[model samples]
Target: MTSTPTRSSDTTSSEYDSDDTNQSVHSDDTSSEDIEEVDEVVDNVAQGDPIWECQMCGALMWYQERKDNSRHSTVPKFQLCCGGGKVKLPLLEQPPQLLQDLLFGNQSPATKNFQTNIRTYNAMFSFTSPGMKMDTKINNGKGPPTLRMQGQTCHRVGSLLPLPGDSPKYAQLYIFDTDNEISNRMNSVRTNKDIDEEIVKKLKLMLDQNNVHAKVFRMAMDMLNDVNFQDVKVKLIADRKTDGRIYNKPTVSEVAALVLGDIDSASHRDIIMQGQSGNLQRIDEFHASYLSFQYPLIFPYGEDGYRPSILLRFVDDTDITKKKKLTIMHWLSFRLQRRKGEALTLLCSRKLLQQFSCDGYTMMEAERLNWLRRNQSKLRVGKYRQIAETPTTNNQSGPTLKGKRVVLPSTFVGSKRYMDQLYFDGMAISNDRPDIVARVFKIKFDELMKDLTKRHILGKVLAYMYTIEFQKRGLPHAHILVFLHPTSKYPTPADIDKIISAEIPDPKIHNELYNLVRSHMIHGVIP
Candidate 1:
């Protein structure tokens, strides 16, 4: 979200501030699944013990026992993967300095044959050192390794095969091993295509500002086509320089022309899709609170990673505003807290919650919650961050309880330092009286900010965004998303619809609805 411009009688508004030079990235997808719980348990052996413990997954072994044990076991004696050989030469080789030149094949061998046949009988017997052989180890010698040799005691871990570094085979290996996950992600924008023109025009119109910024572009394609994806294509579609009448703007590709220099060499298969669309459909009865009205939408917001343009499958009446509040207490960890950017705030209706078994959605893949240990194993758990928020039963306000309110500092909200998913509303002072234009732009905007202290929702309002769609003929109605306190309560759908219809910025935030004008855009097959 960016700055809003003052309204005028001008037919079309000016372009938004599109200089997204700061490059604010939409959230990146993350997973803590493979993060093993490591505990360093020094063996009870004496201080001088020769065993070197595996620091990886916390498994221990005595040098002799490890050398003699069988190789096949579910619980490996060593934590890290080992190269198969009778002896791992790199792991040993005393007089560390001498080992460097020998391993590098830089030093002259003791004998001619030793130089050419490093692992042959000729090299072993033709030593040029004073009195040494490759097959012999001296226990008490002050001489170099060339003078005192040891038997070949190589390791026998796996096959002594080198891993893939740059070959296509390596890429395929990693892809198949990870279920082709790397190829599916749209992390860097270099691969994603440009945004459509209609979408760019619409976003500028929706927010009512000039010079909007298109920061990041998100694109994704699932390995499984049937799986649900959200907001697949995203870009910072902000306003470019204004040209008065038309508010001429540069396309995402135009301002980002510098990056295009490398596009020809990039493979289309490698890059994922990004940016937004003008029309998108809603998911069926899945979310009761999400789509009370059918209206056009470009992106579908969800809890997981973004995918390209697609129709919604189910009605996800999830209340992000309320969910964000609980996320802090449930998901983040101290390490994560330090890294996650800000405290996220969202508005949600508490009463919409069906079952508060105190459990939250499970994460089979990318997760945005605080990391925790549930059963000694590193399994994920969405704890009891649930708080049912209901507006005053009596509409009475004197520190009286009509609804539940939990106030947490921005630091602890959502565990990380990220603030997003705000919730706010602006209804006209009177539903019966109509002050169409001025009230919609100015008055509503003022009331929107003023509603902050009212505890309409539970989080702080850092950034805000809303939409104004042309409902029937020429006039516009709004579908906005705000960024505020995580604990904010959800505004009911009925209240939201009534407020939005008046077009005075009176629509209440709905945890479960979309503008009716957006219904056609809700159902498209995801690529």
Candidate 2:
């Protein structure tokens, strides 16, 4: 066994027990290596001019302190937090600052302060912070009140707007684009000290009674999406300057002013829905996204013989088809029936429905619904089914019921030679709606395949057994489908409006409303 030689006696390997000798032998070799390593480190340190550098740990300590004050400085002591022991790691003073600012990111007194502030700001944007939290000013867990702005626009950048002579809208302007998602929850404070209290009042009302999501919130999100386009457009227009907020931008508080600070002049609603007297001839469904600008201009509900909060369905354009009239008739029929029984109606952008009026049909009072009730029994299922086993669209017709041998149509939409649609109000069936026991569509079946996994409207796939097509006169109309979720995320019409966006859909309460509206509409129009 190996043994360390002691001053008292030359080491002897003969006197250890077997186990003790085994341990002792290993320690002797290790201790010798440790001593050699320490000597080598000391030698390397002696080579530097003033101080020795320990290359292993990259330690630069003063050998001069050891040489000059051999008694005290050479043995500078360091304390262990625990009570067991103390240590001496040698003195290593960092160099004094010369141009510290440039090296330490403290180029100026201002820059030094900026760095500190940046650390604070970064805590919010970055996930690196451990205990960092977004202040109540920026992100209060309780969301802010939704503002209902009458005047706002919802158009994206580079999107085309309807114009004459087709030169294209050369200048993209964002003056009208913005959302009231600008919240009281923002970290920025505004002038209204009682804003929070006011919001609380509304929220309480909503919590206590309102059984639906806030419509205004949906509007705010739509506006926010539109804002991105405006932000990009305005930057280019200003070429990035004070005129553009993308430059040395204002604080969140200043943004509050830019958004909620000013209000526009209020005006007539007809101008909003249709257009100023001479502006409109017909509503162009394709260009309607820009119509957000006209929202405020839409007349208040009472202006056109409709009740308070009710606006004219259409403001301009006088072309109405017999089919459109009948469809509105059926809608009015359902609204009259259900609203009196329950407040059943749909919510959508007023711009889309501005020109939609039945005139005499729309002008009917709630009292008039009672008159229709006299013949309501005649509109019952058993009776109507027998009357309309057949359906007609332009020249296309479904097979007539041969004593209950009704040959269901193979599809709802097809090419001109084949379009077997069964929309309401064709010259066939004497312009009567038929009992639709079954329906199908030929093409664009993808629209009907529902996205089973999605939790949002955009996430859904088109669901169809077969696609149904609807046509107005001979022109294509937007497709109409229904969702009967065993557990739909949106259960009500208002719920649907809040959950979905620009793609507005009308959800009928029961099969009754569904079939009625279906009879009135022509699908296969929306691209």
Candidate 3:
């Protein structure tokens, strides 16, 4: 979250001291006047107009009214918000050197490009708003307003780049570390069972030597050993306040400056402050410009923006009251209408439609399963019971029931009724198969086998078999075996070379095939 610096009202010490001295000199003529002067000085020191602001929180205070007014110190500390540095936060370790060079190094094209379009870059990466709101209804419209911290206060990152032979960075580094991971897994089950300290010690020693998350492991160990660790609080959001009309809350730019290690740099401040114009860009503009810097994957193309080649299919040009414009929603609506049932209508509740559109079938399936589970005894007593009890004539023994049965009738999943209900099930009608990608792969495999056998692409397939399987990420793939006729078999190396090639297709001659191979056949490192 970026913080903006607030302009404080300047009060010169010379003017204040001179005015007070003159007042005191005249007041020395009378005891009452001297007492009044003393009271005035005390009041000025206690609750007079704020002149200095806290660095962490935006809490304002008079120079003399600071938490620590040491004579040796030029500036005083404010303690109300963050307990005068008692609440310390872990430092955000600097990014990799290569990344830093690309982003902030001198005479670099990446840096130049980034700086030239900093707004666009920031917009591409940032996730949440730094701006906070105050609850005016608190304290019955009295005292300081209660701070209402909303939105994401910190970056919620996904997986980090898997660099070869290096400790995992970011969230993975924290989670997979020996101490953190063991503590997390053990704590969940610790209530039910006691943890063996000896076993834990042995595991930690083993992990310390070979752990992939060693960096965070060392950091965690150090933090555990530190006596002052209890005082440290991770700096996530800026929660500061001021009383009355003295608005001292820091701006987004100031917060950003602090985070970027530019707290004292005038040139960086000038750039962030937009060249001393004192006029800050709107929140929307700030978000658009800086978000990209934080989450690059979300906006991979940077300033190029998302421009899909889709047109609006259902437009009402006749309605002159508003301009007709194409949008992503229009494209979605158009794609949805191609289904063979009733026309897509905008007259229904969009929220309900959205609910059913994405995971309605899954939800319905869950409900059906739950119903079957609840009525298992009732289902087992009827025709399902007969089907389960019916034994094979040559069977060594009748089928044995291992657990409670929850039979799904043919009518529920495979009959004409089941097919008919699909039209009204609110599922997205697309190329994808029902429920899972494995089904789609099965269909494609069937089509390929049909073509191979009928068209003889692989020469009179004598026998063929395939097993569909899913990857760790749930993507479906297949392993196939085909036996060709003896007459069509490639017996020589030359014959095999003629029929099969490993080289990529020439894009100029086989544009479509080249694209297909590039998009689907090719695989690369995950990162």
The best candidate by lDDT is 3
Write one digit per residue (lDDT tens) for candidate 3, span 350-413: 3223322332233234445666768867755465556556455665576665555456644477
- TM-score-sorted candidate list, best first: 3, 2, 1
Candidate 1 Cα misplacement greater than 4 A, ranges = 1-204, 208-262, 265-345, 349-527
What is the model-wide C-alpha lDDT for candidate 2?
Answer: 0.26
lDDT of 1: 0.25
- The residue-by-residue lDDT of candidate 2 on 1-527, one tens digit each, is 33222222343221222333212222333454543443344444332222222222222233332223333221222111100111111111111122122124445654343233322221111101121121324323456422121221122222212244322111111111212122322122223332333333333233223211122222323443674532221110111112210122222222111223223432222112110112222211112111212221111110111112211122132223332221223323222211111111111212113222212232232224333445455434344565556555687667654553322222312323234443332335323322221121222233334333243344444352334535443332234455444565466788768656553245544666655555555344432
- All candidates: TM-score: 0.13, 0.14, 0.17
Q: Sort all candidates by lDDT, best to worst.
A: 3, 2, 1
Task: Evaluate residue 65 in candidate 1 and report its C-alpha lDDT on the 0 to 100 scale.
Answer: 33
Best by TM-score: 3
Between candidates 1 and 2, the TM-score winner: 2
- In order, candidate lDDTs are 0.25, 0.26, 0.38
Model 1 weakest 10-residue run by lDDT: 291-300
| Candidate 2 residue 389 C-alpha distance from true site, Å | 51
Indicate the worst ten consecutive residues by lDDT in candidate 2. Answer: 79-88
